[model samples]
Target: MKALLKRGFNLLDSLFSRAFTPAWNPLYQLGALSFFYFWIVAVTGVYLFIFFETSISGAYSSIEQITHGQWYIGGVMRSFHRYASAAMGICVTLHVLREFAMDRYSGPRWFSWVSGIPLLWLLFASAIGGYWLVWDQQAQYIAILTAEWFDALPIMVDPMASLFLNESTLSDRFFSLLVFLHIGIPLALLLGMFIHIKRVTAPRSNPARGLAAGTLLAMLAVSLWRPALSQAPANLDMAVTEVGLDWVFLNPYPLINSWGPGNTWVLLVGLSTVLCLLPWMPSRRPKRTPVAVVDPDNCNGCGWCLADCPYEAVSMKEHDFKKGHKQSVVDPDLCVSCGICAGACPSSSPFRHVDELTTGISIPELHIKELLARTEASLAKLSTDQPRIMLYGCDHGSVVPDIQSSTVAAISMPCAALVPPAFVDYVLRQDLAEGVLISGCCEGDCFHRLGNTWVDQRFSMERMPVLRTRVPRERVRLRWLGAQGTRALQREVVEFQRELAEAPALIDLEDVSSG
Candidate 1:
């Protein structure tokens, strides 16, 4: 089932990737787009609130007035609010499913997946309450079904159905409570969203400016084309024969109507339980790799590695060794072992003697010293006359094409961010390779969360252990691509080789002869 889900997701992703530039791909920016829609809902909702009346007698009338009298502003705002809410629901659902399809919910990632479950419920509850404020036939239908469901549960002593037993049963106070929930639940949802992304370092909460503007413009066109209107004033005594529904948020209403409230509750509870528990389900796999560790003696207490850590796994504490200099410590539970911290450490340079080459923070399996040895061996096999190009790639990213050419060699790291900047310097200065090509996960879609970002910063000299100015910047090239972008990556590398051949040689042949 998981394999099928992954295949389905990949098909959609491929279609989107081909149709739109990778930077603007909707599949890659689901979470960001969802947040963008939420902002639209929040802004327009505040505008509608000024005209909305909370009294039970006036609620339906005020909505009708806004839908007609203030059609230009209030009416458009109403449609924007409704449509954005629907968009948010669709985007969030897809985001959850995509995370599941990719198997990103297990082990160290369980916190985000679990926190997102409550967020889903909060969004549903908030949307349901928003419908109640419209006071339409659809709203009446929802309230009736919801009251019936509440009554089905044994927690409440008095049946909630009694509130809808007669038209008079719903007082102004009842309308006020509904207003409070409509406004309050969304406020709570904002907090839930913060919690949802708490584990992520530097979360991109909004889509790029161009994509955001396009989305809002599209929503505006929709609003003007078919403005949202309230249905005939909700008459509790009359049956609802015809009602419009925003399928995104109201999809379950049909099931509730057919299955009855008890069965609907059972279905909802069962599905939510299954979703929440998915991360812990047993899988036939080997034991997990050990998390990153901090070498206190090697650490200079610079604290750069701690800041670079994506999962907040590293922290600094004072040590007596260097007259109260801080030492780094790693929290095994929080570290995802991406090795960005290792790359960030000033001590990660491979220029030291072989036995002494180590970093302040290192992943047990793929430390810098091990990477240095592998790189030396790979470079040794390449012919000296060839314009040898070394490609450093992320394991989870685009496959480094298995080139039949004699000039190029590829090495895969746990993530591109794991490649210490000094390795690039060593390869270039030591004449091991004429040029280095760095590739990783696509921009905004890194598998290890911050691998691409950190690596970019390092190369640009904006982070610790930065690629030095002495290395000719023209000789190094970076490309970000998705797993399916193998052909694209190969084309870029071929271009890089062509450019490297055209440029004058920077390596000193006399130094190579003497060594």
Candidate 2:
């Protein structure tokens, strides 16, 4: 368990995002919220499109009727459709920009950024369809321009001109097709969203739900007040300009129109192609484990080591250390070399970091440096009160944000191993102190070679209280932390404070006779 505690929280700065916001993951949140908004836009879009007239003549009347005539479902649905589309576009744009700010796009997340391009295009395409359903002059232009662009593509045999010539593909049919496309394209985008996030586990959700609820309430309220009205019917002949131009969706249309189809084609396809190729981008995954070699002679056969190893790399197969108990054997292939097995060894045999024993390949990384700096800071903030609480945090166990520094007096150490036996004694010697909390990585995945394991034995198993027996007996605790164990660290802090609060005044240990 000590091994699990070593993972530290990363500090991030951007908009409303935090590296580790609550126990609720922020990664899963963004993914889900993006999806939720996509669904929202889709649902509202369907409801609105059902009542919409696609013909340049009737589209304006149909939208006006839906917004003003149908006060309940159609009215609300029309505004919702527009709002949801706008919200999704805004949120996704902000979300991606936030990721960019956080530098999440550069590393393993390159795929996410790459896949996001298609999603953006699909969203805009869907947005454009929403505008086209209004069947206003703006929508007419969009429909014609979009068709012309498709016609320009060599893949299609003059699709725009062919659609205009085909008697079956009238404006009414245009509306139907746009409805079909708006729904279908977003459906495809949803699949892409999943693909973008397939590599990640347990994504974040902080702003997603909150954003959804806020969006729903806000849009609903707005629709109730001043609902949307479709503009005068589209007139390709008159060249009429004024209409309900959904800038969020149709903003690109103006640019595309001005730039000509060729430039837009180059920009869109070029950008999309770049986004799709992100996975090939180089990155790194830190080795989660190191290798371990066990000496058969000192094995206790208690299976504690086996139980302690987080990856299940260590198992007691055959030779029993204690009488008939099976001796532990470690699976080299599965082991990440976390050194939790070394901590669990009951015989108290000293073990080196797996790197030291094998090739000594394990080297300190950036996180380690961060931990040491933070540890020195934590140590300086230690306090001695009526029942002072001693907090021993492994560098990797907790994420200490700058804003949260006031409450926690943190002390960082290389490993739980560096926690000398006397330190606990020294802390306990201080009047008004309760016990000590030694938080390390999860017991099995200790980064150091059995450092926490060694600490566990010398304090708990070997040491005893002089007379009260209770003083040294249970005064020390061992907690295992994972890489993302911010909540655990916080809980430990509050619980330790509470325990100290409940304890009686510190006693003078010198009076107790050694038993």
Candidate 3:
């Protein structure tokens, strides 16, 4: 089932990528777009609120005045409010579906998926309350059915539907409740949105500037092309036989009306429960990598490891042995075991003796010492005569292109971010290989989030654990490729080798020991 859904999503992704370049693909920016749409709805909603009257008698006419009286600004605001709400509904639904399809709702990601479910309910209720404020035929249909749906529960003394039987039965108090819900539900949704992205290292609530501008323009075009107007004022005396519905939020109403309130409740509750439990539904749980461990003996209290940890799993505290220095502490539960902290530690330089190369922070499975040993072992197998090149590949990305020739050898790391800048310098300085090619999951699509991005920044000397300036830039090349782009990676590697051969200059090895 997961594979089939992923295939469908991939097709949609391809279409969007073709229409708007991959950088601006709406499919990839669903979460950010949903947040952007909320801003649009909020701004337009404020404009409508200035002139909106909440009482039963005034609600309908006031909305009509806003729709037709001031067609230039007020009408546009109303249209924007309506269309942006619909766009948010679409964006949030697609975002949820895409996360589920990719199995991102499982394991450590369950918190985000579960938090978002209640956000969906809050958005639906908020939109429904907005509809009621219009007090039109469509709103009337929704109000009646909605009241009936709620009255299905036995707890209510008088069915909510009883309030709408006649004009005398309804009051401003009821409309006040509608207005309260319209404002209150969205406030709750804002809180839920925060919780939804709480686990992410750096949540991208806002999209690229270009994408934002494009979306706003598209919304404007849609609003101007087909202006939103209120239906005929709601009349209690007349029956609503025919009315246009905003199916996005009103979808459940038809099911409730057709299948009866009891079945509708059953369907909604059952679906929500299943979605909430999706994380544990799979037969087998994914294996988690070993978390980082702090070595107090080697720790100098420099705190560089704490600064580099993306998950906030590393904390700095007073150390017993080093009075003035602070030691790094690891929170096992919060760590994703990316091994970036080890790379950030200055002691991770492999130029030191094998026994002395330990870092203050290191992953249990891929310690710096173990990594150094593995790298040397891999290099030992390669012959010295041919145009030798060391290939560094990411475990989560493309299958390391198997260079069958004796000229090249590859080493795969758990993540591209795990490769320290000194490790690259060590390989070059020791003449383990002629050139090094660092490859990983593409810049925007890292499996371990910012792994590839950080790797690029580190090598470019824009971030910590930077590749020193003395290292010849021409001897090192970085490539970002997705899992399906092994062919491109191979081509780039070959090209890099040719470039290295043409230059054939070595980096200064004397300065590497100082790092």
Candidate 4:
């Protein structure tokens, strides 16, 4: 059944994901957009119904008047209302099915799984309520059928039949109650939707506007043509007659009319159970995690890789360089391993490994390419006699428009901690670049939470003893730059640039020859 569901929705899933660039699961956004468009329908429904008449005789006339006399705007409003509602129902159904297919409703999310059953029920009820407003022939049949089912509940006497149907109990108050219910039922729908995803944080919409807007317009066009209007004021006297039907709201409404409400109720309830429980069922296989690995030798230790890790798993440790800086490390336990790190690798040290681990590994080839790129760019802008700003930025940091500049050539890295001692010695030898400023994410903000922490760890007292051979430790410094750290980045860059100008050059010739 799970496989079948996946097969059925495979096309929709692809379209929705491609519809808009997705950050994670496509269904995640699909469910979000479902919520968004539902609100759009409800809001439009309220506006359209604000002037709607409740009396059976007046209801038909008022809707006709809305369509005919006020055809221009009312036409559009009615179209919007129908389209939005249908789209709402469609997206919501898709959402429930998608969740089930993806198997996200199990474990901690079981409650949300079960709560979704109410949406179908509420939507169906709302559709019935929609028919009731048109006061058409179908609306009359719907009312009669539903009222009969209500009578079966054994709650109260059949007042509508005993009074209105028999020309005895008719009153303005009865119409008012139906009107109130139509207005109130949507409140239940709103509550149901809210309850459905209560556990999800942010509960964002995935619609990219085009698909969402197109769906609304399309539904509206269909509704206006068939516009859910009722049969002529339901004659209590008439027994049975040919009548128009709208299956969109409750495609099975006519069946309920023929087969009796009791059986229909059972069938609907059974289907609802199946729909709601789907997300509840556990998946046969565990979901795969997708993050790559970084090679220290090929990795320039730019820390770009650290900023992109959304799950906070990658960190920098001492890399290939002698006794000076650290390399980026991956905590297998925390890595969701989204290959955003691999995308940012300067030396391309990190990548999806085709071997045993499947994590990307940096080797000599990758490092040489990046090394040449960095070397060429630096030499091109080498400040001759004057002190030049030595800007070291993480890969993720460089993408930030503020950080990318001529003065700052990003040291694209798997993690900031990977900056080796030997690299520092080589940079100081260049004479043009004054002071080194390393920028990456703040301590806890590192997508790989401890990656930045590792940067701090390697730069701390533990690694200082080894730094004596590489370069004057004072020439190189580190600072954390969070994704949101625009101001801090600016401040650090300026401060580092000033420090480089004022500071003496590391005139050592030791590391230059070796390089």
Top-TM-score candidate index: 1
Model 4: residue 262 alpha-carbon error in angstroms: 2.9
TM-score of each: 0.93, 0.58, 0.90, 0.53
Writing each residue's lDDT as its tens digit, candidate 4 over 1-515 gives: 87688656654444544554332333435666666666776776776676677765677788887776676666566666666676667767777766666554554455666887787778878767877777666766777777776565556564444543733445556667877776688788878878776644334544546656665666566766665443566665675487766545767767676787678778887887876665434543234444355655555566656654544457787776646766677766554433445534444321223232111233232243354356447645754544455555554332333554566545455455444333444566555466566666543334333445444544453432123345556667776644445576777776776766676556533445456
- Per-residue CA lDDT of candidate 3, range 337-443, in tens? 77878888877888766555787789987888888887788887888665578787877665674643576777676677788899889888888877888887655
lDDT of 2 by residue, 290-330 (tens): 36566666554667656545445666766644566577776
Which pairs clash inside model 1? none
The residue pairs found clashing in candidate 3 are none
Over all chains combined, what TM-score does candidate 4 have?
A: 0.53
Report the C-alpha lDDT of model 1 over 1-515, residue by residue, as the tens digit.
87888778767777876677666778888988888888899999888888888887688888888889988988899999999999999999899988887767876678889898988889999999999887778888888878887887879789887877667788778888998998899999999888888887778787877778888899899999999888777777786788888788878888878888789889988999988888877772224778888887788899988888877888888864777699998888777777888888888888876476887889987987888888888878887556789898887778884642567888887788888888898898888888998888776677877888888888899877789988888889888876766778889888888888887787544355558
Model 2 clashes, total count: 44
**TM-score of decoy 3:** 0.90
Q: What lDDT does candidate 2 reach at residue 478?
A: 66
Q: Between the candidate structures 2 and 3, which one is better when assessed by TM-score?
A: 3
Q: What is the lDDT for 182 in model 4? A: 69
Assess each prediction's global lDDT (C-alpha) against the native.
Answer: 0.83, 0.56, 0.81, 0.57
